[model samples]
Target: MTKTERQKMQAGEWYCCLDSELSALRHQARVAVHQHNTAPPDPAEILSPPLAALFAGHGENCLIEAPFHCAYGLNISLGSSVYLNAGCTILDTAPVTIGDGTMLGPNVQIYCAQHHKDRALRAQGLEIAYPVTLGSDVWIGGGAIILPGVTIGDGAIVGAGAVVTRSVAAGQTVAGNPARPRNGWSGQ
Candidate 1:
């Protein structure tokens, strides 16, 4: 039996993004996202009913500000006390997990899909996806971009405007373009 495009994507194998199932899922996510973004602002509510139901897992007190976008909401999991600021975009072709107390600043982007290097494959919309995990108590500053397959460990701090291409160890502080470790700065 052949694997579905979604299955291949989740397995980190090249798959066509033009598959009908994937397209439908993306459409569903778009509707939910739009509802959440345009709904009447309720200070007490962050994730609207439709948007919350779209996610695979959502823990208590998770707050996602408006203008949040994801390719497929079902691929995202959020733990308790997680806060995502406005204008965050997640291309969640694969699983994206955010542990408890993780806070992401405004305009943060997380990408799970990597397009094929070959021009023909790229033109064909073939890509592979890898899971991205942010452990408990992680803090990602504004405008940070987390690439596919990156795991940020517990208590880690990612600096503003950083492009993280690699995993960050627990309790580590990373800064700069490629997100290298910084000696000090606990990010408190």
Candidate 2:
């Protein structure tokens, strides 16, 4: 039996993004996102339920500022007290898990999907996805872009405007493009 595109995507295998079911899911997510983004700014009254309904799992204390964007909200989960600032975007072609007390700065982008390295394959809309995991107490600075398959450890800090292409060690502070660890005296 052949696996469906959604199955392949969820399993982190190569899949076609142009599949009908996936397209429909994206459309549904977009509609939900639009509602959340445009709704009046009343955290207790307007935002929480819709945002909670959009994600696969989220804590009660999770707070996300308006203008959030995601390809598939069902693949994203958030732990307790997770805070996402304005203009955060998550391309959740695969699972994206943000742990407790994690904070994402404004305009932060997390991507779990990538196109084929081969031009022809990419042209054919073949893509591969991998999960992104941010552990507890992680802080992602403004405009940081986290690439596919990156796992940021607990208490790690990603500097502003950095591009994280690799996993960060626990308590490490990484800065700059392609995010390298800072040479500091203490991990704290």
Candidate 3:
């Protein structure tokens, strides 16, 4: 089979190489970030290089640290002055885009793919993908779980530990399992 074609065989060789390539890249980036951050400097420049390697496209002044995970290399893009804290994991099976000046708190999980709910199909490891987007100046609080195809609008604030299942409007503050708008516009 070709690179994208996966047979029902026990071992998928194509998948292994792709995964390995991504893993190596991530590892290298992680190491570089760790090394670069050993000494602190002015806050104006970007703080992490590992984060840059993980994205498909990235602008200036981004600071991404902690642990991160993704599927394909070309499925992610990020804008300038973004800060992603520790333990941020991104499942980029599809596309994931983050706009400028967004702050992602610790332990934030953003997933752009979902597996089948059916146990048999899920066990078979067959699944589809969906893309996710976040607008400019949004703040995702600690431990938020953003699901597939969710578009967080500009200046939105996602509360800590909320499980977001849908799109959020501009300047909205949302919280809860299936996040809904909190009091009012508090996007700052």
Instruction: Give per-model TM-scores.
Output: 0.97, 0.95, 0.75
What global local distance difference test value does model 3 have? Answer: 0.73
Model 3 regions more than 4 Å off: 1-47, 185-188
Tens-place lDDT per residue, model 2, 68-108, is 99998999999989999999999999999999999999999
State which candidate, 2 or 3, has the greater lDDT.
2
TM-score computed on alpha carbons, candidate 1 = 0.97
What Cα-based lDDT does every candidate model obtain?
0.93, 0.91, 0.73
Mark the regions of model 1 whose C-alpha exceeds 4 Å error after superposition.
Answer: 186-188
Candidate 2 stretches with Cα past 4 Å from truth are 45-47, 185-188
RMSD of each: 1.1, 2.0, 5.2
- What would the per-residue lDDT of candidate 1 be over residues 90-166, giving only the tens digit for each residue? 99999999999999999999999999999998999999999999999999999999999999999999999999999
Q: By lDDT, who's the top model here?
A: 1
Clashing pairs in 1: none
Candidate 2 clashes between residue pairs 3 or more apart in a chain or in different chains: none
lDDT of 2: 0.91
